[model samples]
Target: MTRLVVVGAGITGLAAAFEWRRRRPDDEIVVVEAGDRIGGKLDRIRLAGTWYDTGPEALLGRVPEAVGLVEALGWGDRLVAPATTQASVVLPEGRFPLPAGTVLGVPASADGLDGVLTPTGVARVRAEVELPPLSLPDGDVAVGGLLRERLGDEVVDRLVEPLLGGVYAGRADELSLAATMPALAAQVRGAGSVLEAAAAARDAGSRSRFDADGPVFVTVDAGIGALPAALVEAARAEVRLRTPAHGLRRTAGGFEVSVGTAAAPEVLTADAVILTAPATKAARLLGEVAPRAVDPLRGIPYASMAVVAIAFPVQDVPAGSGLLVPPVTGRLVKGVTVSSAKWPHLAGGEALLVRSSVGRFGDESQLQRSDEELAADVVADVAELLGLSRPEPLETRVARWGGGLPQYLVGHPERVAAARAAVGEVPGLAVAGAAYEGVGVPACIRDAHRAVDALA
Candidate 1:
């Protein structure tokens, strides 16, 4: 039997292991995770007698792999989706509604979005329909650059910054449009009109594949962690937690993966190596075997982020789905989701759940703040935005992800291509994770599938 050693038990890593088992049921595979438990980035915690998804609570409907994987794991009944389209986008002046039909940050459905944009701002956005898109070939360009050319600085600062930062923890100017949102970029490259693409996409049935209506974004009834737990369960205990890789070396037939943080690592050899750790960590372990891949792989930037989850009496909570804080608001938090509303089952009965995400890109102080400080900041933001006065949490829970979402810079696709080219230098090696192509859970699953095929 072939031995396949996987480094990191993140969603991508675990997905890789699952895919391997699926391809060759008799093949021996070992998934070494540094954390004491499985699910590296996805975590579930209970606070105030309710469950809260501490990490990656919800993903957009644009990606499909996440949902498919869940169903494949025999968890078909564990799906849930967002019901309403309500979102409060914070502006420098105040938080306002995120206009519908807006593709990315550009106003795709801005017939009456004057509340978010000024008269001049509205005119600037309207101009996008008249002017042609700044088309580029299939290559990476700064998201800021694209927005600046097509839209304007105001829209980018006021909306795009906060929205993308909330999800990717990246600066619009440095993040890669091609890597983060390739379909939107393709609209510009192909049709030369975002509006047209938006119209066409909205007209298509496949657009809602992830949502409840067409196919809204859905999480497992048990929580996002259920997907990972199901994956590990399906593997039948082939995963090893709390085992970090010290280093890795390429061999003739396979690669020898060094595990353990202590001196003299416990080396395990395998016919194939799938590294799904953060960009920096993956580059470090695979540097010697794939030096050319290491530089670009490491260049993929990530931001440290923290989330504060709070529980409240269901009836006492403010009545809204969620609110998004744009960086232009001069606030520390990126957004707040009324978890109780998005997926009611997570906190049913008499209590409500709320999750606030803070710190992204360059906000070191906010991301590094103490648990108490974070909870206070998040609470304050949520209370003010939701019109709740003197809102106190029944229980406070905090989770910090060091170097969270990767910053796919202007040349990310090139870097990813270069990384793949370098990986080609070593046989039986592959990369899988949000850093490579996609950031949402579905994209990660899709990336994992690609890696498994490569290994096979």
Candidate 2:
């Protein structure tokens, strides 16, 4: 039987292992993770006497990879759609509904963005079509730069920045348009203007599974953090937790992986190896066998953030699912999700749960504060944003993720392609993770299948 070694047990690595088992059931699969737990960022913690997701709380249901995986594992019945996906953006003036008919805050039409954007800003957006026909270069362009030129600073700051921050925790001016919003980017190239491109993209999205009537995001009743354990069990591979793979080198038969502490190292021989560690760790491991892949991998930067879950002993809270606060507001918390309002499973309890996210790409000073200080600050920010009466939290929990998000800066697509092409040159080597493609669960799963298919 052939042996496959999968380094890193995050969603991508575990998904890779699962895909391999599905294709080659008789093959031996080994998964090695440096962390004490199996799940990387996907994890759950007990807060206010209930299990709550500390990492990503939902999956994009429109994407088949994650939802399909749930179905394949016989957990289809456990899927849950949010009670209300409607969210508001908190501005210095007041809170307003997140404008609809937009792809990641880029308005398809300026109809719904009246209050969200200043009157001047709205006029600028309406004038976009009147501006000279817009065209993208042969290569990628920064998302913020393109929008600011065509629309204005107000649109980018008020609309796009908060949404992109919530997803990547990175600035729009630095993010890649092609990598972040490929659908809109594709339309931008051929469409007459950015507004026309956005309208086309939004229309196309409505025709797909992401239509308004259907659920765009989904989660399990048990919590999204539970997915990693379920995936590990389904794969049924030998998982070596807290076992770091320090070195990887090509061997005559296949490959040899040196893992564990330097003082007590052990080697595992496999016919194939899948490196799913973070970009930096992957770069270090592939230094010898896939030197060309190392630079591109290391070039990818990461952002750190923290999730503070708070339970207040009252049901009366904000009406919407959450509120997105742009950096322009100078709020300590970037966003706040009213857990009890969003998820049906989390409702009907005496306590109202709220999860607040803090920090961005280049800002970690907020994260450096002690857990108590950070949680307190977030709680205060949430109260102000939601117009709550400074309700004391019955219980509070803080979960910090350092270097958790990978930034897809300009030319990210080309960098990833180069890294993958270099790795593919080696017969039995492949790499897959959030750094290579989209950062969401579905993207990671999709890339895992791609890696497995490449090996096949």
Output the number of the TM-score-best candidate.
Answer: 2
Per-residue CA lDDT of model 1 for 1-456, tens digit only, reads 898888878898888888888889888889998888888778888666655688887755545677668777987776776655477776767767677666566566457668788887778877777885546655567878877876678778877787788778888888887776665665656665655655554545354454545445666666787567878777653787778987888777778898976864688989998888888888998777888988888788788888888776555444456887877677777888887776757545666678888877777777666788778888877777666644766777888888778887888899889998888777899888888887878788888899998878
Clashing pairs in model 1?
A: 176-408, 208-215, 210-215, 210-216, 210-217, 211-215, 211-216, 211-217, 212-216, 301-407
Q: Estimate each model's TM-score.
A: 0.92, 0.98
Lowest summed lDDT window (length 10), candidate 2 = 205-214
Report the lDDT tens digits of candidate 2 across residue range 342-425.
Answer: 999998887888999998999988799999999888888887677776478889999888999999999999989889988999
CA lDDT, every model vs. true structure = 0.76, 0.90
List clash counts for every candidate, in order.
10, 0
* Top lDDT model: 2
Give, for candidate 1, the lowest lDDT window spanning 10 residues.
205-214
Supply candidate 2's per-residue lDDT for 369.
Answer: 92
